[model samples]
Target: MKKPSKCQSPGDSSISAKENDAQSNRSRDSKVAPKSEGLATGLDETEWKSRLTTPEIVLKEIRTLEGVSYYHGMVARDLVESKLTRCGDYLIRATDNRIMEFEFILSFFNKKRIHSHLTIKCDVEAGKWALGLLSVNQFSSVVDLTNFYKTNPIGAGFFLKRAISKGKYMIAHDRIKYSPKDDLLGTGNFSDVFRGKIELENQMVNVALKTTKLLDDTMDPTKNVKANKIKKEMIQEAEVMSQLRHANVTSFFGIAVDRLPILLIIEFCNGGNLQGHLIKFGDRIGTNERFLYLHDASAGLNYIHAMSITHRDIAARNCLISVNGFVKLSDFGMGLKVRRNESAEKVAEDDDGKENKEPKLPVRWMSPELVDTPDAFSKMSDMWSLGILAYEIFTNATKPFFNLDDTDVMQTVKSGKHPPLPLSMGPDLIRLLKDVLVAAPTQRTTADKFYNELHVLCTQKGALSLNGLTINQIRGISRKRVEHVTYRKLSYAIRMVTREIGVMHHRRCWLMLFGGERSEVSSRTGSF
Candidate 1:
């Protein structure tokens, strides 16, 4: 399989004639030099032959055929565009329904001119009909084209079928199912979580969904607030998640909004939250396990930050562990869209109104600015929270700010005081903690820089002794907590129901005594 040469000029017939001879080995190859028209006068026979053999030309011809579709044409276009001019290979499907393999050897005569010689072998037909060019650029480059086809075979197939059926390309049909089971995941005011099957598409598999919720409850209607807020948050989160198609981040399935409870169905993580895992397994989780969770969390956060959104709440609780050991950042409730022009004055004003009646902020993990003023939130603040989370994970669920009351913590934060790293903590971690937990927001490290530094610390040669935790261990801890909390609420409801029954009986007796005598007297007077 000799490579094809690049197209230089019409007069440059050496490579073209050579390519024709090579292509003729399998089937008879003919070179036709039609006179150049108008602006194409400078174009010679070789240039014209190159244009005819070009992938673009082949793709265009394929589109005109009855079976070839627009999407396949696009895929073909991408495959060709990405090819190097000199070293390219392609699989051509001829107009007469035969496959021919060819390679192009590219060379540049001048900056403006190039030449190519195509070596081809016809697998089926003997003579040339209308040649449909599918050029291969290099050996093993087929993998690149294969990957593209694998990702978009359905799309291409749909385009082909659509063009054939309708005589023109139309919108492809979306057959994604949206059902009640798909609507199980939801985000709350304080937490973002989801409950759904892990494998909704094919088999029955259990999975839990995770996300952050940031919508103000004061704005949503009371009766339908939670559902409405969850729905809206899910929609927005899905939109954002859809844009972020990364392996480290959670994978998004099709969403179901037509039902009463709108669901942003996602692949469930059977392993619970990191916070619960540490509390349950504590000393059992090795250093490497710890680093794994941290690494995955950092990767996910880095991706989020890259998309210009800060995961404001980066805690163990928000880091979800899957049964298969995959870690994903779940809650997006507290996440904020990074703004370019966030003024300090505007932040101050927003905080001023909420001074008297502010929601109880998580003091221990909160950044100094948040404790000092409610509106003092930024990307730096999120980094501070991440630092606190890392500290919690490292310590195996020790109290975030132990031995300090909320007021004292607030006061200390206001005065620019921060908790010191434990003596046992490694230098890399200690540095990370100090850098993120700096009192001044301006001085705090950015998420991007933090992630890069963390990656180095984790991957570096024995910087810190740590390993990653499995997703199941993390989930086991979190799930137990959720179950226990649920049981407590259910028990409370049962007790309340029993007490209410007795009270209702007493009230009924009292009503009968007060009204019974009056009713009897009225009946006797009617007779008189």
Candidate 2:
């Protein structure tokens, strides 16, 4: 019988071809292979075994592959080793049966290092042989490259070392790149936003990295819980943001969690936020400019709602502005997916009588149904918040419910009461606000409707060019002014409550000091 050929094996042929090509290329170039320098070099089996037994020799072997290719190779090797070791020859057979089904993911260290797209295929009989040994499912399933890398760093490291020996390994865009240093740009409840630079193929790009602390029982009790919650929230937000691609929304780069404190890289908006701009030029900005800002912000919110995502927190703080005065929605921390016919009752009941309640729903901007009933909020609720945001933009950063308590605000909303706006505001804007702030969720205007109407209004008002504001400008202005107003109102309310408590305390003290005399005086007054 003819000897079996390696080409008859599914992945084996490809593997052999790859190895042979490397060897042939190296020989033609007269280049020395790094592996040849090890104990295997010019040594018998017994000598090599002795050298391999030494820890120092093993360490030297590891140091040989210290680049990106080394890491990728290590990952691939680990994946192969793990599957083969666990399932044995069955896996080898499965690969042989369906070699073409497998995908080869080449992750580059840098974008420029990649010369061309990868092409992978397997031999038919080899694939069939592997499949006969293993189940079809095992051989046909796609592999997760990221998970493979996570488990097999050593094997990946080795492969990468060899692959990059002759040429530079290119980086892929999807791969996570490291920044030199963490520069703190903004701080939130659980995360500190950093301004970082990532090196791409030929140039470096600026990105905002939101780094959050990890939660562990070893940490302070209060902080541990808060950190965990924040981490979950950030993950959800990142997931939503990454899937979304829009000019009016902030772009989410990939997230990194390999290191403690997960990092969320995002496109850096150059223009300061809307709140910042308002502070600097509140007086200088014309009425048309303010109207344009509102129109742009509403447009963004409309896009989000159309995508079936609700921006529960639609305050000015979340609207980022670009240097060119374009507004993009940012900070999806409080966003929730609102599918049709979903019951909010379940979510509310799940949290019923819990120690930590849902982050106090944004009371000031929330619609009546959102506050009063366990109704899964609709797009209209977002529209209500948008109305509040529009009012803020137009009124030089003034907040709605500037003086109302949470209870009172809820009551007013339930009672269909809205904050007064200046008479100078046009009827079209007023009509749009009313439609959005309707007490019934069903009565609320749809985002598309709102955008269309607003666009028409802007055109009629000769303010069509307002869409040019950048994301940074919007965020800066919205953040500074809205946060200031919220905190300021909260402080004032606390002071008022404190004063009332003091007066009540004084009356009680007097009554306690002269209880008998006061009782006698009350009786005499009643007799007179």
Candidate 3:
């Protein structure tokens, strides 16, 4: 068994002696010419071969019969359908797309450019398959093509199995099963999010399942096209989600494609979103507690920025609060990866200007630059949203630029005016908001630096608690009273320890702490 050279043509002497000699000379010259000199000219035994950008297997057959004429190759196999086109004097194009035996004809028409004058022929027969060719240079083999459609955030779309095996975050869709009729968490243009459950590491946990609508079986052609577009967008969102894993970021379990409308299984937050939390708890929550949520949101934003991602839509509604009081950022429809030296306008805007129509953007939260060019979303633009988020938190979910339309908000921001800080906000919190809310995107503070500053302010405000007591609560206690409470606790611990252990063992514990032999300690205490 021997492999063939690239563009190798078989021998044929059916043409005139002069043409045969010309063909022979060209064959010899082709061997010596640079392989990069892909296409050359000659007749029936000539080996002027150009490397077709076809699949590896298809190229092999094409090279085996490059010298054969088109007429004879077609007659040799009796193929159901065939096509021929004279691209130039040097090249001939042939294509076949019939669901029949695996027989491929490889031949070309003679140089006289007459359909009746067929000079040579070669036949290739192999295993069975049929592929339609939209172009002469493209080929799709069984091994290279998969029936299933799949995509991820950072790589080319591939078969479902390959996607799962290749990506670190990808999981098999079969591993997830959801209730057909469940409480719908939310709905979007092309998807409906439902509360579902999935088995993770042998534990059944609640998850949010976002499923894309079925487009393949749509009755309307227009809707079918739109559905496909939405499916791609959702897959892109899933791709970004798979790459991310942070304490303050929502977790993506995997994609469920075992059925219609691909499903994205994600971690469920019991406390809902920051928007609802503020609206419900409003006046009952203190300023310090609100700062804690702000800190969490900032931490998430910083993590995403470190990974070079711009969460184009950042607002209170996009932030989720866990039942345990942890805040995680969610919703990644407008997320985009930053490229080196790319301008905001190029990276942020969709080329088609379709993102502006459906799936509305946060108008009041958007920065001046983003307002002008929606695609100009950057880390700085995210900072602007963070400012709005802070205001929403402090004001108990009050809408930014309340009662003002999109135009009003844009004009006000451009005029160097911003929402006033809530009366409850201290000087430090107000300063942090000012840094993020600057009209100029370039002047805005970085997410990490802003996060650090807010963290410090949070600590200063006694937003952090120690052993169930906030610093403020602890401050109100008198020193003598605190000492009395500490002494009582100490006595209680000693009594409990003595009851749990025998007297001899308890004496040994004291001796170990005091750096004395148990015998000596017992003698001094006159106990054991």
Candidate 4:
């Protein structure tokens, strides 16, 4: 299988892992694979034992072939999707029950940005393998079959060319080592997070280890029955996360499954979550700082939308603050990949057979449409949440509709009612909020446009601010002013432009612009 990229970027959040699910028998379901090292080396003991142990290393003995994409454990469906990035990107893995009708899996990326995971048929007596339930084309070995398909396209015009290999960051080994963890970051219903250093061969990367509590319940037979179901969902989320590459989005390190105490590891952001950061340091965040935060967030969201992933839950709490102060979107437990002309499947698909439980929805952050059809989250819904996020930043991170209960808040939210700008960031923010906080989804501004506007807004240095000035006074000014000299005037943000020019000159310039008498408008000098 292709490796997940280590490049940094941004995106959004989560809560419900899944609906009661069952073990899905589907094959590959990803759309990423770069021209890569492929299988740099044969599958060694370290690789084989990490994934599958019970099967007895029959394939490991075939040292001549260590082709990538072959797996021996569970969640092969997810693993395949995470790694396949391009057309023909493929992998083959041993089926959970190889002795059954199907012996292996052949998964590859499709040009349509979807993925295909096909079951491979085998004739044990003939020592041959073929595609699907039956195929006229047969090969002596799995590697030979994969090689043939690289040049020959398969179902729906997909070519199995670039076989994926797990890079250093994505740990699949059950016994992979790491340093003793320290510094508890946070906790949730199903996990406890701690800051730690993960051991890689060449170096140690800072990481946040979130231990999954659901799978550790060994005493409950009922729980064990849905273990694979839960793992499949978890694996699906991690795989989707694996494809995220942005500085504003927290990176997924890997998950240690096929063992106890399965840890969901990711990049460590020491500044904690954006919501807590704002609550604790609201006084420190100002207009410029707020703009920077929004700018970073929008950049992340833009990338997320570009990738066709809808962050079902987007709020200040879901955004993480890096130590360097960049806003990164994280906590993607509820993300959904909404591809063009395709059904919007969630990262973790709902399983009808699993236990029934009430979903703890992020009501305040949700759009009205989501409340109506909870599963139908989209980019426009995310835009509505972005409007709330802007409100959070300007309001010093205060919770919106604090006066209303969650159930009651939905009434206000559903009616297209939102709080007015409680604090003055600028009119740019006001304009942004107006564009996003609309009842009609089509009326909302896209994250791409948000990013572009912020790009300009974030560059403002307050050298030409005209905030709070009357429209008449602004209209009165002509070409010879300080603003016309160097910078574009701010629409409505606090500016210390007068400080750049002398205060006397600033007053005189303003007076002169308004047609004040020569005596009233004092002689303004080019000199300070």
Candidate 4: tens digits of C-alpha lDDT, residues 1-528: 212111111111111122211111123324433322211111233332332322212232122232232542334465457767876677654333311111355666778777766666554445565675336677776677877887776755666667676443335432233322235576442345666665455455566766544443222333332444556666677766656655577767676542233456776776677787677766755566666667667877876675557786677877886544456787775233211112332122122234322224556777767655666778999999888898897777777777777667767777878767764866766876788888888888888777667666666655223232211122222212211111112211112455565545444443333321111001121110
Stretches of candidate 4 above 4 Å error?
Answer: 1-72, 76-169, 173-183, 189-191, 211-229, 334-359, 461-528
TM-score of 3: 0.53
* 396-495 per-residue lDDT for model 1 (tens digits): 8676657676667667766766666665557777888788888888998877677667767766734333233333334242211111122222323433
lDDT of each: 0.42, 0.44, 0.48, 0.53
lDDT for residue 41 in candidate 3, whole number 0-100 = 15
* lDDT comparing candidate 1 with the true structure: 0.42
Candidate 2, position 519, lDDT: 15
Root-mean-square deviation of each candidate, in angstroms? 27.4, 24.8, 23.9, 17.4
Residue 106 of model 2, lDDT score: 29
> Model 4 residue 208 lDDT?
72
Error of 4 at 217 (Å): 2.3
| Model 2 quality (TM-score) | 0.50
Q: What is the C-alpha RMSD, rounded to one decimal, of candidate 1? A: 27.4
Off by over 4 Å in 1: 1-194, 198-202, 209-234, 334-360, 372-376, 463-528
Model 4 Cα displacement at 377 (Å)?
Answer: 0.8
Worst 10 residues of 4 by lDDT: 6-15
- What does the lDDT read for residue 292 in candidate 2? 69
User: CA shift at 329, candidate 2, in angstroms?
Assistant: 0.5
TM-score of 1: 0.46
